[model samples]
Target chain A: MTASVPAIINEFLTGSFSTIINVLKVLIPLMILIEFLSVYHVMEKLSKKLTFVTKVLGFSPSAVLPLLVTVVMGVTYGAGTLMEMNEKEPLEKKDFILIAIFFFICHGIIETTAIWGTVGANVIIISAGRLMLAGAITMAAARLPFFKP
Target chain B: MDPVVQIIKTGFIKAIKTTLMLMKVVLPIYALVVIIKYSPVMPFLERAFEPAMRIFNLPGDAVVPLITGLFTDEYGAIAAASQFDFTAAELTTVAMIGLVCHSLPVEYALSRKIGLPAGKIVIYRILAAVVVGLIISRLGGVLL
Candidate 1:
C-alpha cells in the first residue's frame, strides 16, 4: 500500500517540524550543561571515574561524555557534544572509528528498548545483545593490527 | 558578564549552530524518504525479500516491516510489524535489526557531519543487523 501524493507531503512537513522541535528541546539544555561541565571541569572529574570505559574503548577521557550521550540520547544529540569536544581536542582516528562502531550498534538504548518492546520483543535480550555485541567488537577493534590508537 | 551567563550564552549559540547543521542535512533526506516510502519501490522490495526472510526465521511477509524499518523509522516499522502475528523470537529479530539500522539515509548523512567513518559503520551495521536477526530467531524459546 502506497501513500497518496498529498499524504506524503503532509507527513514530511509535520514529521520534520516535530523532529526539529524534539532536537532543540533536548540539545539546548544538554549543550548548556556540557558548557557548564567543561567550565567547572566536571566532565574531567567524571571521566576519571570511567577509566575502565576509556581503557576498554581505547578512547581518551574526553570521549566519555559524547559516547555516553550517544548511548542514551541518540546520534544527532551525541554529535553535538562530540563535535565540540573534538574541536577542543581532536580524538584519534581509531578512537573515533571505535566510537562510531559502538554508537551505530547500540545508541538510543532506553528509547529503542521501549519502542521495540511494544512489538513483543524481549527488551532485555535486545539491549544486552547490542551492548555486548558493540562492546566486544569495539574492544577487539582496539587491538586490530591496522588501527593503532 | 557573570560566569554562569557566559556559559549559557556560549552553549546556546553552539547548540543553535549544530542544530542548524543537522537540520540542513536531515530535512532533505526526510523528504526523499517520504517520497520513496510512497513509491512503487516498496512493493518491489517486499517481493524481493520474501524468500530471503526465511533465513531469519521470519515469515515471508515480514519483509514489509523489515524494509519499512530500514527505509523509514522504527515507529513505522512497528506499525507494519503489528499487522502480523509475530512471536517473541520473530519480534526480537526484527526489532534488533530495526534498532541497528532504522532511518539510514538521514542518520548516514548526520554521521558524515561528525567526521565519522560513516560508510564503514553503516556497512557493518547492516551486516550486524542481519546477523543479530538470525541469532535471535534461533533463541525463540527463551524470549518472552
Candidate 2:
C-alpha cells in the first residue's frame, strides 16, 4: 500500500504539471503584453474617449479610468483601482453599481481574446460586444424605475 | 547595450513576471476542471445544469463550462465558448451573460471579506447577466 502511494502521487503531479503548462502557453504571453501596456500608461489616451462614451451611460468621467483599465487588464486590477479611489473619496452608490456592472459584463481582455481566438472566434468582436452590452445595460438600468443605483 | 535593446529586455522581464502571476491564478482552475472532467461526480451536476442551460439557449455540454466559470472565472466560459461554432452575436451574448453571473463562488468569497452578502450578490449578478444576455441577443438579432 505504501509503495502504491508514490505511483499515485507521481501520476497526480504529472497530470497537474502538464495541465499547468498547457494553460500557461497562452496565458503567459498575454499577461506579459497586457502588463507592459498597463505599466506604460498606453491606454490613457483612449480613456478620454471612453470618458465621453460613459457619460451617455450615466457614469461620471472619473469612472472611465477604472472601467477602461479593467477592460484592458482584468477585473481584479480594476477593482484594486476602485478600492484606491474609494480610499481617496467614497464613490456614490450609483457610480459603484455602474462600475461593478460594467466589470461584471467584461474584463481580462487578453485571456478572453486568446481563449476565443483558439476556437476561431473573432477576438475583436467578443471584446467590443461586451463593452457595448455593458454600456447598453447600464443605460437601460438607469432608465428603469426599480433600479436604484 | 543600445537604448532599444535595454527597453526590450526590461519589457520582456516585466512581461514574464506578469505572465507568471496570471498563471498562478489561472492554472489551478484549469487543473480542477481536468479533475472534474475525469471524475464521476460531475455528471450529476451536469444534469442539474440542463434546465439552466436551456434558459440561456446554451447546449447541455455548456453546463460544465458555465459551472466552471462560476467557480473559476470567465476564462473557462471562453474556453467552452470557443469549442462551439457560435456566431459573433451568440458568443457575445453568452459572454455577456457569463460575465455577469459567473465566478459566483470565488467572487462571493471575496465579497464576504468586504462584508457583502454573498448570496444576494450572486442573485443580483445572475439576474443582471441573464437580463442583459437575453436583451442583447434580441437586440443583436434585430439590429445586426
Candidate 3:
C-alpha cells in the first residue's frame, strides 16, 4: 500500500486507540497496586531500608519513598508523590536534581518490560544499565559543591 | 469503612485521571507520527539522523523510533520500530536508548511542575542516553 491519505488517517485513529488500550492494561493494575502498597505503608517501610543509599545520593531521608516509588512505578506517579513530599517538607534544588537524575534513568521496571519484552530485548541490560547510569549520575551530582545547599 | 477499600477507590479514580492525561499526549503524538510516516519528508529525516544513529550501529530508518521515542513514549517507538526489520542486538540498542530518553514533553513538564530545572533535566537525559548507548555498543560489540 502506498499509504494513501485515508489509510494514514485510519492508521492514526486506530493506532491511538489501540496504544491507549495497551498502555491502560499495564498502567491501571499497576496504579491500583501502588495505591495498595502506599495504604499499607509498604513503600515507606522500603524507603526506610533505602535510607543509606538516599543519604549517599545526597537526598534527604524523606526522598526515599518517592525514589522507591519512581523506581518501581514511573516518573508520573513518582513525581506526584514527590510533589506531595515537597509540599510537606520542601526539598532543596539539589535534592530535586538527584531524585530526577536517579528516576530519569531507572523508572518503570514493569512498564519497560512490557514495552521492550515483545522485541526480545535484553531486560537485564536495559534495567541494570539504567540503574548503573542513574547511580553514577547521582553519585557525581552528590560530589558537586552546589549539592550541599 | 475499611481504610484499605477507601484507598482502592481513590487509586481507581487516580488511575483513570492519569490514563486520560497520558492519552492526551500519546494520541496526538501517535497521529503526528502517522502523518509523518506517510509524508515525503521521511527520507529526509532518515538522512538527517543517519550520522547520529551511526553511533548505535542502527540503520538510518532506525531514527524513526529514536525520534518517536524521544518525543512520545515507548509504545510509539515500538510501533515505529515494528515496521522495520532489525536484528535482536539492534533492537536492544534501540530499546535501551528509548528507555533513556522517551516521553520528553510530558515528563520534562512534570519535572518542572515539581520545581526542578526542566531544561537541564532534559539535556541530562538525552546526553545520558547517547553516552550510555555508545558505551553499550562498544562493550557488546555484537550490537556494532
Candidate 4:
C-alpha cells in the first residue's frame, strides 16, 4: 500500500534489515557468554593468568584487572574499569597512557571478531593480527623513555 | 532466581540494548548507501576517493564504509559496506581497520578520563588503523 516510497528505499530497508538480523544472531549469544563469564568470575581467573604477562611487560600489578576487562570487553567498558581503578588504586601517568594506547588498538576481541565474522572475514586471522599488533605496539610504547621513565 | 536464568536475562537485556544502539547507526547509513548507489553523487565521490582507496586494494566506494567506520561505529561501516561487491582481501582489510579504529567520538571522550589528550588518541588510532590496513591488505591474498 505504501507504493509512494521509492524502490531504492525498499532495497535499502531490506538490505540493512537483513544485516540487522545477521547481527542479532551473533550479538545474542555473545552477550549471553559475556554475562555468563562475568557472573562466574571468569574474568578474575583470566586476570590472574595475565598477571605474569603484565609483569614481564613492566606494567604495574594494579593494571591487570582493568586490562583484562577492557581487552575482552570494548573501549567503553574498559574505560569504566580504568575510571574505577583510577579512583581506587590510581596507576601512574605512564601506566595509564600505555594502557590507553594498547586498548585503543585492541579491545572487544570476541564481540567484534564475531561481528566481522558475520560478514565472512577470517575470524582466526583477524583476532591473531589484532593481538599481535596490540602486543607489539604496547611493548614498543613501554620501552620508550616517555612511558618507561 | 537461578544463576543461569539471571545470566540469560541480563545477557538478553544487554543484547537488546546493543541491537538498538547498532540500529541507530546502521539503519540511516545503510539507507544512505542505497540512496548513494542510485544517486548522481556516487560517481563523483567514488572518483574522488579512488586513488586513496587503491592503496588498500579497495574500490572508491569502499571509502564510504571506511569513513563511516572511523567516524561513527563499525555497525554502520559494515552496513554501508554491504552495498558493494568487495573482494575477500578488500573486506578483510576493511575489517582489520574497523576493528582497530571505530567510535572515535565516544571512545576518545571516554579515554580522556585517563588524562591522555583525546586528539592524540584519535590521531594515533587512525595511524594504527592505517598501519594495520596496509599490512592486512598486502597479506590478504594468503592470509584469507
The lDDT per prediction is: 0.75, 0.64, 0.78, 0.83
Which structure among the candidates has the greatest TM-score? 4
lDDT of 4 by residue, A1-149 (tens): 22235788778778988999988988899899889887898878888877887866668777877777888876677777788777888888877877877888888888888877888777887889998898888888888887546
Off by over 4 Å in 2: A1-25, A120-125, A145-149, B1-48, B75-97, B109-120, B132-144
Q: Tens-digit lDDT track for model 1 on A41-101? A: 6645676687788887766666677778788656766788789878898877777777888
Model 2 C-alpha lDDT per residue in residues B25-107, reported as the tens digit of each score: 55555555545554565576668776776665555556665566676666556544433356665665666566666777777
Cα lDDT of model 4 by residue, B1-144, tens digit: 998999999999999899998898888888777777777788888999999988888889888888888788888888877878887778888889888988888777776766678899899989999999889888997766
TM-score of 2: 0.69
Over the stretch B31-137, how does candidate 1's per-residue lDDT look in tens digits?
75566556777567657876798888887667766777777666556655655578887888888888888878778888889987678777888998888877777
Cα lDDT, model 3, residue B89? 73
Q: In candidate 1, which residue ranges exceed 4 Å CA deviation? A: A1-47, B1-48
TM agreement with the true structure for every prediction: 0.69, 0.69, 0.81, 0.94
Q: Write the per-residue lDDT of candidate 3 for residues A1-149, one digit (tens) a residue.
A: 35887888887777777666766776667777878887787887888887999767767787778888888877777888888887888777677778888888889877776657665667777778778888888988888886555
For DockQ, the strongest prediction is 4
Per-model DockQ: 0.47, 0.25, 0.54, 0.59
Q: Candidate 4: deviation at residue B74, Å?
A: 0.9
Candidate 2 C-alpha RMSD relative to the actual structure: 5.8
For candidate 1, give the docking quality class from DockQ.
Answer: acceptable
Worst 10 residues of 2 chain B by lDDT: B76-85
Across residues B26-128, which tens digit of lDDT does each residue of candidate 3 receive?
Answer: 6766776676766778788889988988888877878888888988788778766665678777777888888989889978888778888889878888888
The digit string of per-residue lDDT tens for model 2 on A1-149 reads 22254554564466545434545566656655665566567767778766767668887788788777887787677777777777897677677677766666677766666655554444665567777776777888766775664
Model 4 stretches with alpha carbons more than 4 Å out:
A1-5
